[model samples]
Target: MRKLANRPGGPKGAAIIRRGWGKVLGGLTLSPLMAVLLTPPAAAQSADISQKVKAECAACHTETGNSIALPFPKLAGLAPDYLAKQLRDFVSGARKNEIMFPIASQLSRADITALADYFSRQKRTPAMVTKPQLLAAGEIVFHQGNKENGVPACAGCHTRNGAGAPRFPMLAAQNPDYVVQQLQNFRSGARTNDFGKLMRTTVSRLTDDEIQAVAQYIASVPPPAGR
Candidate 1:
């Protein structure tokens, strides 16, 4: 496994090897128990914890990563490792959100993994309201890369179908508020560690309305099938 240098939008936590063979072991070479232990957890172990976490998450993140308002991304189908890293970021102050830090501080690494896994496993539903103007602009931004501005399409890295890779989080059904804040962080150089600083440059040029539109459009989109 190679250690990717800190870059924008990349995992924001202790320097765990970003890529590991654990994600590649197959069948009998890795027994189920071994797989469980070797693999970072994606969701919680018990109903009690799941319920507790869900309630806590609901205070900020909407059910399954959806937010009640713009910029709060839906959490339903993000990659578990990615989610865990974000939680770790909050706890370590690599990322700063007044509400998120304290809440994340209460969780153990295992707990973060479990919650992330559970959300990643869920299906993302659309936001009930979509502003027409923002949707139109966001649609253009999501599918069409802005070359002059040096912005890549969201699909370039998130994948055409929005199924993100390991450590790359799913953004299809995220809360717009969460997404906006994250993007703003990128623009401000606060959220570094992404691959190539792509998102930082992308968000830097966006107007507030553009941000809202893009976030809303992405959130309203459904997760890729089987996600």
Candidate 2:
């Protein structure tokens, strides 16, 4: 047997190798093999929802609810309750969005719930802060509001790290431009979804510069680890 093994070129050598491989392969079960083939890659697992639903959302928010589009807000990592509320508002015309109103109006309550849950579980990519020069001014605005202008500190509602509370949004890693746009909308009364105009009143006293600075600062705040 030793001599036969040593002589690898022997006629039996080929059969021996095939037999060994067969024995090893025999140990693998069909379920495990199917799972290996069927499972999506780790990074892509976020799109576990139906392809139709994912495609619909992907057009604007992307499958993971993280989009680089400056106009769209990051939906990933936000509380499911908040997302669900926003969707319902859009559907009911409580939140006036020219683009989203039609699409959201068509969705059922279950669809809204599923999308909210799906996006909430997705990990959000970090936002890139433009105009780093404004960071200091932005930080001041975020942490300590301008008393002279009657602007309240953002940290009081958004938390020190901007992680936000139940109704408050998770502002960390949000696009600065989008943040600025929303503030402007609030101040201008173009967007009035905030309960009792809380955002409208809060931003009413903020100057254009202050709004920009605060947005820039918010972009600098990192999202929670692994989220």
Candidate 3:
């Protein structure tokens, strides 16, 4: 009788068969374990950042960064870079806010980054629209500048939906009163931190009516779905 070890498919074939079985067993045993070890749930990831926002920023900005107060700007969905820069400005006295100056002064660069990351991820609540009539004019100003007044379209930098770029800020769903105040500040030179005097030059040409129209339009922007 022929010996099994001396068969045409010899030790090499037997070894390959064993290796295949080992791989199958290893995959079945290790996959679930690896997933549990490597992948944390989303809630777990956000919990620490959520706690920090609650402790330091909830009083004025609210836990979600959607404050209803007129004086405080809604931080939800703001550009992270813009938020970080503003915080740094507060720390350096470039932006004067008695409330923010003290709070921001205490934060380290890492803390600022954490806060910016947290707030930028939050969903913004749309501010209620009070002036429906002005939406047309506001839309015009936002999408197309008045050539005669030398005013550039607000959407040129902020995007058509008001989702702003890295340095610019998201104006959608912002409080109208807050928007007006910032624009006025730009016009009056009270807020000089704007890069290249861009805001000042743009706001200077806007009439009071135009400002109001734009603010109302921005405030009326609907919140993103499922947010």
Candidate 4:
């Protein structure tokens, strides 16, 4: 937020970054929230599952899945449904992050569910505020969804309310810088775990204006109920 120029995961305009796609789509699972209501022994099973995930992922993901540094996304309070979908996507080759592929690959359905459940319940720190001008631009893109460019509204998937379903994350309140980085990743194929291949195609067409507008808009909005 403090004009992080040239910093790691710094502002790189709207270019894409490519990474592995096929290796990310093997370990798929449903969200804990859903599993809990659906499964008979969800509570006890989920507790054990969450513990296992922490032990495995905490080394790099840090406590509560919130990284202290830049570039790494703050996983605390992410939407469980979104997280579960991503883990599945990474395994299924729909999404492709170099770091995420291997980690996701090792996860079992239970592990993915537990991780999503844990992180989705944590709180998201605020996105650093910078480039108000850019954020203003990002707003238009988010609400409008760039029909001319064939991009759908982000709210459609993440939900306008920001109470994302079991696997779609609540983008509201996330770091604009992080969002920008992800968009660039999606555009360039760096982070492809985007649902339905929509983000990849949509992000690819996003201009500097669109990126700034969408990211800012998402950051400006407050998380919805249950987020």
Candidate 5:
């Protein structure tokens, strides 16, 4: 009913009201889907990122998030939430990585989020196939399980294209050596971070050759668009 702009101290009151509104908006949280769709993408958030953290990450994984060395797994085009969880797991000792544990422990919640969001947006390059001969065998094992042994298809969880969801990791175009090592870790019970021991169970009965073949095929798979 009152026109504040026309009254004494109206301008200051309006400025205060505007600041209050900004705080309210800043405090509001976005839903998962909305956050992805509405937030300024990782590239645009560079100004707010910690240069020290980013540099450390780029030292192992290239600035683009692809690690050509094949020792550190590629991070490009992975789910941000998935990446965040891995970082947290490293800090919690759920995923025991001597190198990662200290680095992750130093990260604040904001740092973890920024790192995940940044890496997830980086473009991922397709991996090179080391064993061309095994592609066919690998394809079969990836798309269809060994029914006799009750092995479930890798695609059933990682998706047909291996653009994994928030819980599952992106397997397509990942380093074959890295994949093999992770599978072996799962099999040996060295890695227990997988929910419900799903990965351990899945790869438990798979032969070493089968694991290698699948990793090879997965390495060769070009990630689908918009992963």
Candidate 6:
């Protein structure tokens, strides 16, 4: 056999090693650049969704879904699944709202999903509290139910801070008027979309004053961080 170390620092061996290292280094240098080039930006992906929200939803909910108006509920920080379900309910006549029904009817399922995702990620602004007394009264109801009236603690389902679960909605910082209206709706059978009539049952025994107090309390509470 030929002496292995004798020719041009073993030309074929050195050349092969150099080529292999060059390929490895090239790949390492280019990998991140290639990823950046190939991947679409997050903002770019949501651009169309943002436009759609601006055109259709911003009029009432605002661009960030943090509407301050009593007539419109804030959509920010709500669970995406809940938002999507509400949109679908409006479309299907399960939730009756003349304004929302028409708008929701125009949207495709994909549009609803996109809107839900967009709004759910937005930060929620705190709702202004105008009634400290009502808020105090509501806080009691929220944290501890009226056992005499057979009412369960709102926090039991909505969490102590009102962060809410996947199915239950976040009630903290919700518009007081909107919350009251929903409770009335649930009590009167005007809105029946709640799973297993939970809202209806919960609100059934609550007096008008209790409802108002709870709504005021919910409106006054601050949302969880990033919610």
What does the lDDT come to for candidate 3? 0.85
Query: Candidate 5 regions off by >4 Å?
Result: 1-45, 48-50
How far is 89's C-alpha from truth in model 5 (Å)?
Answer: 0.4
Q: Per-residue CA lDDT of candidate 4, range 46-96, in tens?
A: 667667656666766576665555466667787677778888888888777
Model 5 agreement with the true structure over 187-210: per-residue lDDT tens digits:
999899998989999889899999
Q: Which candidate comes out best when scored by TM-score?
A: 6
Give candidate 2's error at residue 135 in angstroms.
0.7
lDDT of 6 by residue, 139-208 (tens): 8899998999999999999999999999999988999889999999999999999999888998999999
Clashing pairs in 6: none
Clashes counted in candidate 3 amount to 0
On the 0 to 100 scale, the lDDT of residue 1 in model 4 is 62
**Comparison by TM-score, 2 against 3, better one:** 2
Model 3 scores worst on lDDT over the 10 consecutive residues at 1-10
Expressed as tens digits, the lDDT of each residue in 127-191 for candidate 1 is: 54456567878877888856777767887777665677775677776666677788878888988
Tens digit per residue, CA lDDT, model 3, 50-88: 777888799878998998886678999887889999999
What ranking of all candidate models by TM-score puts the best one first? 6, 5, 2, 3, 1, 4
lDDT winner among the candidates?
A: 6
> What is the Å distance of residue 78 in model 3 from its true position?
1.2
Q: What are the per-residue Cα lDDT tens digits for candidate 2 across 1-227?
A: 76876465766787777788789768976585576565676423334345645657888778777778877888889999999999999888777888888888877886788788888888988888889999999999899999998888999888998888889888988888889999998999888889677889889999999999999999889887666
What is each predicted model's overall lDDT from 0 to 1? 0.71, 0.83, 0.85, 0.70, 0.86, 0.89
Task: List the pairs of residues colliding in candidate 2.
Answer: none
Against the hidden reference, what TM-scores do the models get? Answer: 0.69, 0.77, 0.76, 0.65, 0.79, 0.80
TM-score of 1: 0.69
Per model, state how many residue pairs clash. 31, 0, 0, 28, 0, 0
Model 6 accuracy (lDDT, Cα): 0.89
Off by over 4 Å in 4: 1-54, 59-61
